[model samples]
Target: MKRMSLASLAVAGGILAAQAAAETAAADDIFACYKTAPAAEPDWTAIARDYGHKRLKQGCGQQWPVAATPHPQRASAAAAALAVKTTPRPAPVSDFIWFVRKDFADVDMFGKPQSNEKATGAELSWARNNTAADTIWQVNGLVGLAYSYLNEDYSRFIGASLASYVKVDKEAHSAAASDDSRDAITVGGSAEVGFINPIGGADYVRGSWLETRDGILNRTTGQAKLEWMPMYLRVNRQIPGTFVTTNFRPDLKVQYDERQGGVVPIGFSGFGRSLRIGPEATFLFRVADFGTTLPAWAEPLAGLSGAVTYHWWREVYSGQSGSWLDSTIKYDINPNVALAFSYQKGRNEETAKRTDLYKLSLNFKTCAAFAGFSGGRCTADKD
Candidate 1:
């Protein structure tokens, strides 16, 4: 009986040791599954497959591990970091704008031209403006210097302009030549009041008073003259799909020429006292739009552009009239350089002379702003 009891006790002890060893192996397998789990969210199915289902269920209390509650400060910081990584910074803008242009032309016409045989002109313009938000109350002051050489004669001009408008849409145009034939330095100024796009379209209406030291029509030494435009209208239009634009300007002009000594017709006759009514029209055609429709060999012609301008005026009282027609074709080699050919035919009202000329030229333009800002080349009316 004693021997039988000892053997049973040993068997009982062995069964207890086997049970202890199985529990220890199960615990180790659960720990290994947890170490290999995904960081974002644990995959219970994968854990159950790698480790035994019975052990996984026992280790996790028959369910997946509960997600940890996020702390408020930690969550907020994480959101901010994500926003910083995803957001884009704004671009820099400039406060002031400036422009400069230079033109060197060979104006020797096919027929011996009467004016502007060989001409070179340059202009520098600068302006200061308030912010674009304060449109109506903000006034812009513009100053310009110009020099021109024509037919062995040279002229210099310096002018300041003050313009107040409802809204500023585009830059004002400037010419590099004086009105009259005189080798002198002239100083002048102009004041303008206008509104841009008063209705809806790209149109403007302005009244201007321009005074010059030596008038273009009559060169009176050291005498100041005035020209007033009571009504000036500019109309602009664009054609769809064709890349064409048109601008038409019509105005009523009255001038006090020292040569005429009174408010006289300024277009053809400088002596008659009359108001002049005129219209100037310009049409621009951009040929580059056609390149896609043409063969690849004809791609070089895509950089060409053409412009046509017509100006006509009539004296109300004296019935004197004059007209000018100009056509130009330009080829742009690059942004800063261009080659152009132009033909001009005009009847001079003051000198009663007729002019017909052909011009071929090279043009260069550049710009600089107050800040370290860069933009396209400056553009101006070419003569």
Candidate 2:
């Protein structure tokens, strides 16, 4: 398992500056959710040690709600049963492994314009069963990595990557959402991890500490696009030929950069902070062989997924900035391809009265390779 801290290049006055030196660090964050081994196939030893503990905590945590506070009618029934029962019964073990997969995709490299180039990465995972008779009791993890060199200019940044979950079987099939949904309620837990840059410069941070570090230092460059960590929880149900999945993600993030330690005689100082929250929902049609294809949720479209986020921030250098709205829409062109569109707008509160943003992208795997494209000019990669 590896961890990486990634950051974007600095952009000011719509200009890109070259860095003298920069390095991309490797990541070592391994997650075991449903099986053992955690690689491509079941590795029994790894399962017994790593993944088993994670699920026990999750399952046991779920029971607390039902045990601590009982419903009116349910409490009455429990009291009567207590009188007849002597010793408590052991917990029941289900008959399935919680298989999960982790997929990472980007519309553009470092917010650069998407060319007709191609890039891709893959990861495999498996879990080790704890109980010979219980098919679901165990833990494991998996990972996939790929890169593309077809693009001109910064072809080195072009690539695809993935990671999968092994203890909780549901994760293996979680296509409706990307981040971990269960971690929101847990004490200290994590979900699938992904890294985008191994060939970037030093002007950006190197490893997995981006969200927290950037939140505090405000050292992020304008070229940075995906650095935050998000958790997701989905309630999915299957009835006959139809399946429904609901996504809930409540994230608490802190971004800061007082740019303290310096005293400027005039002009506004560069300091800022922000917090954001987003939620999502979707419905899938269970098809034959392929299991499920084309799901619909949020917005109005067949096989679509969308979410709305609210961003709040403040700045001492200037004044107190306000908040704004961000929206997104995505569709699965197929198992290996996807298309997305996004928009954002709001007020600066301290300086500018309004801010606007828009984006569109497509990702697909064909001809034994993965490729993507985006509309609108990108600021992260140009000189």
lDDT by candidate, in order shown: 0.34, 0.27
Each model's TM-score?
0.41, 0.29
Deviation (Å) of 361 in candidate 2: 3.3
Instruction: Give residue 279's lDDT in candidate 1 (0 to 100).
Output: 59
Per-residue lDDT of 1-383 in model 2, one digit per residue for the tens? 12111111111101211111110011111112222332333232332222222111112111111233333332332232221122243342111111111112222122221221112112122223344321211111112222322211211222222212211112122333322211100011122222323222211111111111122122321111123432112222344553433333333333332222223211122333322222212222222222445444422343454445565544344565556555556565555454656555774211222446454545332222223422222212111
Off by over 4 Å in 2: 1-244, 258-302, 315-319, 347-354, 364-383
Which digits, one per residue and each the tens of the lDDT, describe model 1 over residues 278-380?
7555555554432247457656766666656666777566777777776667676665455667666885222233556465655433333324433211223
